[model samples]
Target: MKEFLCTDKDFKDIAALVYNACGIVLGEHKREMVYSRLARRVREHRLKNFSEYLAYLNSNKDKEFDAFINAITTNLTSFFREPHHFEFLKHTIVPQLLNSNKVAKRVRVWSAGCSTGEEPYSLAITLADLFPSSWDVKILATDLDSNVLAKAQAGIYTAANVNGLEDKTLKKWFLKSKDGHTYKIKPKLNKNIFFKRLNLLQDWPMQGQFDLILCRNVVIYFDKETKDTLFKRYANALNNSGYLFLGHSESMGKEHSEFKNLGKTMYQKQHNARTV
Candidate 1:
């Protein structure tokens, strides 16, 4: 038996709160996971059961809610987790941007749902390698979880976190700790990235359009309706012919005519599609 009682009603209530708060759908299979994560919150508050915890959360939402969301968010990421995306960015996207953005020489990339900073950092490294120092290049990395955002902002990772990185790449972009237990991203590589906490379901305050948006593996937990809405939003956020990268498992449907599928879960914004 569990330490705290999590009845069906309690699980349902928690699920409802999570969905309403952040668009993540907690199905029946997620009940045990939810209980295991939230049970710690209950213990932290010295609550007797999940029921009391929920009531406390509702009453002190401003304080406890961030903790609640952070506990449940999954932040599994690594440097260059999807190599093909980076390869495509280097080969195809860079060449096009060079031709089209000759006057501006400005490139903007967004790593939505950038957990613990790997995706955006990878993007930064890639851009730093290709783009001239004179060009204005920037990356905006955003996530809903504050804890992970802090970790990402610090740019520190253990040896295990950077296991698969090549020796040359590691030496170029990271500073090894004296004890050799961890590595920190070098300032040159981290300079172009700006991290922020953002909920995708809420309003985005960014005024300029992005040249590429990587929202990989993020929409899998969302329902179809949410996914559709997010895809449209991504379309609007992107510049004409701007790219959007999804996870290997996620794909846009035919109804989303704003984006043209380029295979490998890559998409380019259609030049003549109506934006929402």
Candidate 2:
């Protein structure tokens, strides 16, 4: 009715809405960010106001809540992100795996919140480089957003996707499209990687027990309680000496006893031999 600008109440109301819908907590300082992100929903819905849209979200019997969450959760990632983590995966983790014939034979890596494919593709390339001829590499990349998963499965990306790659690496791993602007990972590179649509809120499909899990920058949007629950579940899913990689900002902290830090944001399964 009146000219609308998002207010504190609007921000709190949205925070509550998002939390209920997806377990994300929009904290106090995020008032402006909440406003900025939801403003588009207002314009798109052409509602009378923020209050009206909020009401609509509340009353709808069944809506595409995943799409709503995907709309808000920022999906920013790149190939070989936090390169040191991959380095650790290669040099430190894989060396231990090599010693144990049981764990070394087959490697299972889960890119928990793989955005548009770069992260998992990066893992595949790293595996190709680090453990070539190791046909036992099985990589699973997942995202809650079906839209992003679709793009991830296709493995084709615009020029912007190659953000931090060297020309030599790009030339080695990607094939420029006939049009010359787009590129895709060569099919040979796709062997180890599989992309699937998954939501962290839902029960994980596979009986995990994975060698490594990469849930980087994913749960930053989730509330603390949700984070604890997810991380505990993650711990359970890992093998006795498996590893977990969180975003530089997302730390396991003292909350979970199942893991110990391995420098940087990297963590090791409690049973693993200590790193110097």
Candidate 3:
């Protein structure tokens, strides 16, 4: 038996709220997941059922809404979760930047939906390893989940959180805690990254264009229309010839002519492409 009563109406209401708030499509498959997650909130508020919880949520939007959003959103991430993206960054993209940006000596990267800091930290590690300290390099890591943002900013992880990394990487970039159960990222790697809370569906406050943007594994949750609009926004946010890295399972259609696919979910912005 379920802990809370989640009627079809309740599930539909939840789905509509989630989609309207963050552009995430909560399908029928997610009904049980949503129930399980929101049940805790229902219990926390001492509510009798999902119906009561929804009533409370509607009446108290300012306080309960953030909690509601945080509960429904899933955050699954790790350091260097996809290694090929980093390898490409290290070998191909960095070399190109060295040549193309030689005069400016500046590089900016955005890790969209940077869950719990791993992806941005991975990018930071790669850039720190290659770029001269004299060069201007910065990484903007943004996510809608404030909870994950707090953890990311802390830059501390369990020893198991870094299981697959090389010993050299561990030694060079992490400080082992006294109990040896936790590792904290070194300042050198963390310095280049700026973590911020961002909703992809909302207005972006970032001023300057990025040389590379990594929105990997994020767009899969959005509907096609939202995805198309996001791709256009990404195209506009990037510098000419800037690179975009999506999740291995995600790919843009030919309709998104602004980007030329380089395989492996990597794409480069076309210089002459029309803006959407």
Candidate 4:
């Protein structure tokens, strides 16, 4: 394979397309990253260089577009990547929701931007550990990248993916294959999770309100205006007493008043709070 070079023009073209399609803000610094990720596409198509690949992309409006986006979009994630959020879910949020008489018994959680099933599966474990099996619990795990969504739906992973998971949790939720390198999530855990491909910038087809929405570590790549718009949409999508979790580096900004910070990047809808 020859060394592929992504010229400034090719980078700009892809950056514009991505921003228009998914609201991801890619700047000059990401040129090399884009080049490396998309180089495989160039090789697969046997294009001469990035310019030829870009030309092919512009001419074709089919699965190739999805492939292009999936190639460049970042999908770095892990099971229990941010452990504190899950701790809060178990200790504080779950208890408060369970104690509430005003809230409905059914719980719906949206793991927005869940990559390769880790976040949603972790949520399933937490719910199983905390809530009764009879409780109506469902988790919607969505990502813009279709390739990752397929992997998430499969609920399979290599040893490296489950590296830090405890022995008890691993044994209880996953079945280790004969090869010893692969693990598949048990049907019990997989049952509650529904994986789908969702682009945050586009229309959301889901009709139900959710008790919690975890959009952590996703909005950091978006521009401020885009972030504000998406956060507001999430606010509308939540149940009155619902919670929203952001990445450690993300905030709702001052524009969104519907959410009140509960510290540790967790938020509760203001309307649900009792006024003294």
TM-scores of all candidate predictions against the true structure: 0.99, 0.86, 0.98, 0.94
Instruction: For candidate 3, give the lDDT.
Output: 0.93
For all candidates, the clash counts are 0, 0, 0, 0
What TM-score quantifies how close candidate 1 is to the native fold? 0.99
- At residue 63, candidate 4 shows an lDDT of 50
- List lDDT for all candidates, in order: 0.93, 0.79, 0.93, 0.88
lDDT of 1 at 24: 96
**lDDT tens readout by residue for model 4, 95-174:** 87787723556888999999888999999998887777667889999999999999999999999999999999999999
Query: Comparing 1 and 3 by TM-score, which wins?
Result: 1
Residues forming the 10-long window of minimal summed lDDT in candidate 1: 125-134
Q: Which residue pairs show collisions in model 3?
A: none
* Tens digits of lDDT, candidate 1, 165-233: 989989999999999999999998888899999999999999999999999999998999999999999
Query: For candidate 2, lDDT tens digit of each residue in 139-204?
Result: 999987777888888889888878668999889989998887788889988877888887787778
Candidate 2 vs candidate 4: the lDDT winner is 4
lDDT of 1: 0.93
How far residue 125's Cα lies from its native spot in candidate 3, in Å, is: 0.6
Model 1 segments more than 4 A misplaced: none
Measured by TM-score, the strongest candidate is 1
Please give the distance, in angstroms, between residue 258's alpha carbon in candidate 4 and its true position after superposition: 1.3
Residue lDDT tens for model 3, 2-117: 77788899899999999999999999999888988999999999998899999999999999998899898889988887789899999999999999999999999999999899
